[model samples]
Target: MGSLVYREELEEDKNSAFTWEVQANNKAYNRQFKQKAFLCWWRKKYKRNAIHTAKYNVFSFLPLNLYEQFHRMSNLYFLLIIVLQGIPEISTLPWFTLFAPLVCLLTIRATRDLVDDIGRHRSDRAINNRPCQILVGKSFLWRKWKNLCVGDLVCLHKDSIVPADLVLLASTEPSSLCYVETADIDGETNLKFRQAPTITHHELTNIRKMASFQGKVVCEEPNSRMHHFVGCLEWEGKKYPLDSGNILLRGCRIRNTDTCYGMVIYAGFDTKIMKNCGKIHLKRTKLDHLMNRLVVLVSFPKSLLWLRFNPWPGIFLMLQMWPKKSY
Candidate 1:
């Protein structure tokens, strides 16, 4: 019996090492494939003719350098508006009045800059590019130091930002599994089990499991709630219960496991996860642009109307339209 146990242990160690080697080779191949594809695409898109067209085209609003510099200066323009508003007497000066249109132009530019900034930050956070702390094993540290890959096994603790979506591989003995707050994906506040597959889809179209964290988490402050929904998959087979250390996809809720390893089938922009993120970003950008246009359309005519009826007409209109409910 002792001999059998020793042989089994040796076999398990060999298997584990073999799996790790396979994973490493796969990662390297994928990295090279992606790099080559990117270079090919870049060369095709930025050929000599493309550069010339972009430069001399009347529709080209500005050169890339000027556009970037203008964007960086947008915040300063916004600050100038606030300063100008505080001093009403300055508006009466001849020079100030003459330059008021220039100031208005600057304000518009600043507003655009503000919107762009919000969009960029949102995109960065959605894709997990921003700096945040995560648990690798015994230590709690920021992800800035370690370069995480898609298929790598990760250990997450309570309150740590999940570096990437992962599957629960193993839990601490005695079932002391860390509770994960998945409010970013699910709308409910309750903690979910990180154990085996409880839910399975029947349709092959729904067999491909996907977990997305792009949606907004709407909950109260502090332990704020997150919003998550079931993902669609396309597989055909009877749903079997997964073991404790079974593979899980990114964005999965690992309930009872302290450590988990997900086979990184998808990573970067090619993954369904990144596609969903891109969709959310596009939606937010469109909404923000529409709101800004609406505000300007409403305000522009009002300002012009005020200018048209200034002096005597302005005083009479103000007196007649003044509210009498000053109590």
Candidate 2:
């Protein structure tokens, strides 16, 4: 037991020493929406809670779809054939023959992608518009999840999903302890416990006291370390150390405790869960690889035929089409 105690003390000392040289980042508080004009600007200071899972929007659909489609060598080959057909001097077939089919193919794919992305847009809207209670002045008012900002206090009820990363404060439970379920975050069904800072748990007992309390939290920058946190809450000229046990991460569900109050530390894209959300990437199937190889094989022979039969005429016509030198 003595040896274990000494080892724990040594580890704590080393951690303290390593962090002692780090500078503090104090978060700004904005309780009232009176600064309404700057609200957008303030939210921008921290990442907005709005999520965009869709790949394309109205303005980008055409160009982006075309770009993705042309990534296939077959599409490029068809396009080259269409261009060749357009040149009357070298044309062996009507351009519309290739043009119509290529248009249909691109249109079908684009329509499919557009339909899928519309569903994503609807999902994003539904989630961003979900209502939560945010502290404004001394009272809590219902607001959308996307409207939440860093340093804002939130009141959560049992079974409610946490909208952002927050530091647990006073709760209805004894000793200000809060119970939460992280099934949405880590696929765990068991309840986890989060405790409020002793100073805050005791002093901020009521809504009025909570509104009056002006505390600054200094912590590490937003990160994906879900089970790790390092910070200190400064209030009334004293700082209380905080850790993961003192936090209620986004996507967690409040359980057992009837009500709990927490201050948002990370919102929207800055939350640990959001940090872990990897970007959506395009996945090509084995069929796509085989088709590309076949297209290359077919195109090589066509190119050789064109060069052997009509290369000189095509080159001469292209040169004639080019603008004469100014000289």
**Candidate 1's error at 19, in angstroms?**
20
What are the RMSD figures for all models against the true structure? 19.5, 6.6
Q: How do the residues 148-262 of candidate 1 rate in per-residue lDDT, one tens digit apiece?
A: 5543334454444454433333344233234554555545568755442333211111101222111111111111111221222112333233332333333444454444323
**Model 2's lDDT to the true fold?**
0.82
Report lDDT per candidate.
Answer: 0.38, 0.82
lDDT (Cα, tens digit) per residue for candidate 2, span 1-327: 999999996676455432211111223433321223364654333666778888888899899888888888899999999998998877899999989999999999989988998998999899999999988887999999998877788899999999999989899999999999999889999999999988888888899987776787777767676897888887778878989999999999999999999988777887899889867666578998899999999889988998899788778997988988796
**Native-referenced Cα lDDT, model 1:** 0.38
The prediction achieving the highest TM-score against the true structure is 2
- Worst-scoring 10-residue span by lDDT in model 1: 45-54
**Best candidate, lDDT:** 2
**Predicted candidate 1: what Cα RMSD to the true structure?**
19.5
